[model samples]
Target: MTAEQINDKIELCESAMDLILSEGSFTIAQLSEATGKTASQIYSLFPNKKAITEYYYPSLVIRYSAMIGEIEDFESYTISEKLSNFIFTTFDMMEDRREFVEDTFEKMVFKKGCNSEFHQEMTALFKHFFTTDGRIAVSAGFVMKDYFYEFIAREYLDIVKFWLNDDSDGKERSFALTDKLTGFVEEVVYNKVIDKGFDLAKYLISHAGLAKNIPLFGEWITSWFNDNEEENKDE
Candidate 1:
């Protein structure tokens, strides 16, 4: 599409999003009436209400990224602080559209093939912070980096869901919860890479209840020991 076409599509989607917020729902005909555009024109851009709702995800991500990117000291903030800022900024942006978000979340989030794009967008956002000082890179290499990103993406959505239902004073509880979760992830990665005092694999196995259900657990443990014995012989 040409630049002008792209701009028009964005404007239409923004208008539709506003309508969704104001009315708690919207149809293409309503959007056409509101925007002075034909129903066919709106349909050409978004085939259904769900598509318009899904448009908010990428649009909001871009807006949030640009907003945070403009902060002069954003890069200087620690990972947890950056995360807190992201969560707060996102909530601020969505404050006016809370109902629309909650209504469309089930329809858009975790759908078979829909989440991966959003996940990638979030991963790219977090990777900027994670790679700032090469902290995440220390423990997360080629094999583990994708998993780390996926975990952060999934946790971010989970936290947003929790935040929507939070009713504590000034929503301070959500901020505190986000801080704890980010801190825990940092500590786990730090111990896994820097301290090495805790064995994450062993901890996972121990906490994985119903050993019989996980047939690979025994084979994994045996292989771990065999590898250790081989290393000992090499030493």
Candidate 2:
């Protein structure tokens, strides 16, 4: 599409969004009246009112990226600080439009195949962290793999949704919760709880009889017994 065409679509979507924000609900006719466009024109641009709101998601992501990109000292900030700023920035931007966002989210839940786009947008947002020199950051012996990105994205979305319903002064409750959850994940990753916990889970599952027919269960059981024997020997 041409830049002019894209700009026109964005303008139309923004007009539709404004209608949603003001009325807490909007129809294509309302949007047409607001934008001084024919209903057919609006329909050509967006199949339905919900699509206009869906368009807002990607626009928000772009605006969010630009907003954060302009931060003067972002690179100097710690991971927690960056994350906190990101969360609060989102809240700040959505403060006036929360109703529309909540409405769109509800519609998304009931609409098949719509949630994946939301997840993808979330994944993109979460990936802004751990980026150095325009690349994903890596530690001495660790890397932020795809699954890690997916996990953090989902967690971030969950926290944002919680924050929408949070009824605290200045959203202090959501801020505290975000901090605690971020710290908890850091602790788990740094302490190797993830690896050890998975090992323990496998051991438990092996003995739970659910894995009796699985070929790997026998070896897992043997390894568990051997490890216990070695520990006893050392003691």
lDDT of each: 0.69, 0.66
lDDT tens per residue, model 1, 1-235: 5656545566677787888667867777787777788877777777777676677776666667868758997777767777778777888867777777777665576453225556677778877777774455343433346667677878888888888899999988888889899887666554445223125444444676423355787566546645754755885
Query: lDDT tens digits, residues 47-131, model 2?
Result: 7776777777566555677677689987776666666777777777677677777776545622322255656765666665654
lDDT of 1 at 188: 58
Scored by TM-score, the top model is 1
Estimate the Cα RMSD of every predicted model relative to the unseen true structure.
Answer: 9.3, 10.1
- The TM-score obtained by model 2 is 0.63
Model 1 alpha-carbon miss at residue 89, Å: 1.3
Backbone steric clashes in candidate 2, count? 0
Among the numbered candidates, top lDDT falls to 1
